[model samples]
Target: MISKLNLENILFLDIETVPETENFSDLDNTKQDLWEAKSRYQRKKDFTPDEFYDRAGIWAEFGKIICISVGYFNIEGDIRTFRVTSFYGDEIKILKDFKNLLLFHFSQTKHLLCAHNGKEFDFPYIARRMIIHNIELPYKLNLFGKKPWEVPHLDTLELWKFGDYKTYTSLKLLTNVLGIPSPKDDIDGSEVYNVYYKDNNIDRIITYCEKDTIAVAQIFLRLRGDDLLNDDEIKHI
Candidate 1:
């Protein structure tokens, strides 16, 4: 039988992305005119079914990646307090910094990177954007050519397969099911883009990302057979 993995070496990360908009100006007048003409095209149809309109609007406006907030439990610290580090700035710079931090942590210890829908969205999105920025991907983020089962990824959504693949569960829903209070009140993923663009508030984006990180952490705790946090243990972003 395979041994159960330890949670001490795991890293839980979450990223908020927006679409690329800088190159829109580089398009010729004809292309620009065409884009302008297409602006009224039903915005709803433009996004993936799983994506929210607010998220799509963010991509439509101020490009993507307003913030990435990461939370991890320090194994060395006896108290179970989670430490958080957030990057909020120019998308490119924040990505670079986040990537570096990930790489640095990986280099020091063998960690199982965990996220909610990381396998489908967060991981690939970060990799693609890194390639766009000509940034080197850390070894942990480089999962190209690996078979699905061979990759060391723990997507909570994927783990839910044991319950029912057909029944999709949002992170918030899973948190509640696991007896962990949801920390999604401050701002949601949908409002991230609008908060960054219309409201000019990157802090909201950070809070949103932080909540996701905590949610993922709770999921990780449950998977490890540890006592999941109750309402008292839950922290607001």
Candidate 2:
């Protein structure tokens, strides 16, 4: 099914998020209590809610999107180009810009959004954040009443699972095994919080996010038994 799909109709993307604030104390009293409850099982006995706050970005309720990098194929004649772009900075602006992209261009019934681990993370995370900001969900993101086969989304991690159900594969690990260039050369997901808060570097995070987006597209091409995209064919717009 993947091989028969049109690459031009798919939008590949990845997101980078950080806790809504720099510290756990930055949250209101009510939110702090909610954090403690939300993170209890994951943090375990090793870390307090404050100590585990760095990872709050994993949840849509606690974190805010700082960057969303997306890539789509632009084909003209025999030329192939994967145009990449990002919407970063203010969370509201970011969400609005993404929604605009979806509505104006990629909102068709044949269009689909693709991301790594998207079904579990990226897709829902975007939707939840948009709702928090009161941004209307785009057709691609709104899944309120959609049946299983009616959803217009694709996940690289889920594709790799192939009904294993228990398998989990990191993008870095998958790229390494599949002969695609690793997207984890520099900082990884774990280091994003510090890079954004402590180091005050968002450009680095944006670059990383775009790399992952490209890696996802490459992984999809590999899954379809297609040739990998060359460096010259990737354009950051």
Candidate 3:
């Protein structure tokens, strides 16, 4: 499938997210009850809602996107460069800018949005957050009546799955097996909340998000049986 697709047409992306608020106490009483109800299945019997609040970012309703970094392959004569860009700061502004990019540049039928485990996490999370912010959904993301195959969203994780339904693959595991450099060298998803709220380090989070986007693009290349990107071929824009 990847061999039939143009790498240049795929906009590879990854996002970093954090809990909507600094702590659980920040939520109102009704929301607190809702969170408790929503999280009870995952939280261990000993773990309270406050203790499990660190994981709120995984759900779009309880958390917000802090960084969304994207990369695309730019092929020149005998050379291929992957250029990366990121949108951070205010969530609504970030979503708006990203939506504009999609609307203006990648709105063509051949263009695709690619991410690892995007079908389950990144794609739906973005759509849900956009609705929450009352922003119009990008054409690629709005799947109101489109057939499954017509969605134009690519999931590297889904491709890797093939037919197996029981197994789950993490991006870190996929990169390790495929010989791509690890993107989680500095911080994994678990630490983003603390890094964003406690340390107040949006730059660090953006850098980490961009690394994951780069890794996603590299993984896609590997899936297409191409060589990993070289250091000189990476340009941060």
The candidate that wins on TM-score is: 2
TM-score of each: 0.77, 0.99, 0.98
Using lDDT, rank the candidates from best to worst.
2, 3, 1
- Best candidate, lDDT: 2
Candidate-wise lDDT, in order: 0.68, 0.97, 0.93
Tens digit of lDDT per residue, candidate 2, span 18-73? Answer: 99999999999999999999999998999999999999999999999999999999
Task: Give the deviation of candidate 2 from the true structure as CA RMSD.
Answer: 0.6
Model 2 is weakest, by summed lDDT over 10 consecutive residues, at 133-142
Flag the better candidate by lDDT, 2 or 3: 2
CA deviation > 4 Å runs, candidate 3: none
Give candidate 2 regions above 4 Å deviation: none
Q: Over the stretch 1-237, how does candidate 3's per-residue lDDT look in tens digits? A: 688888889999998888899999999999899999999999969799999999999999999998899999999888999999999999999999999989998999999999999999999999999999999898999999999889989988988999888889999999999988999999999999888999999999999999999999999888888889999999999
Give the least accurate 10-residue stretch of model 3, judged by summed lDDT. 1-10
> Distance (Å) between predicted and true CA of 8, model 2?
0.2
Kindly report which residue pairs in candidate 2 clash with one another: none
RMSD of each: 5.0, 0.6, 0.8
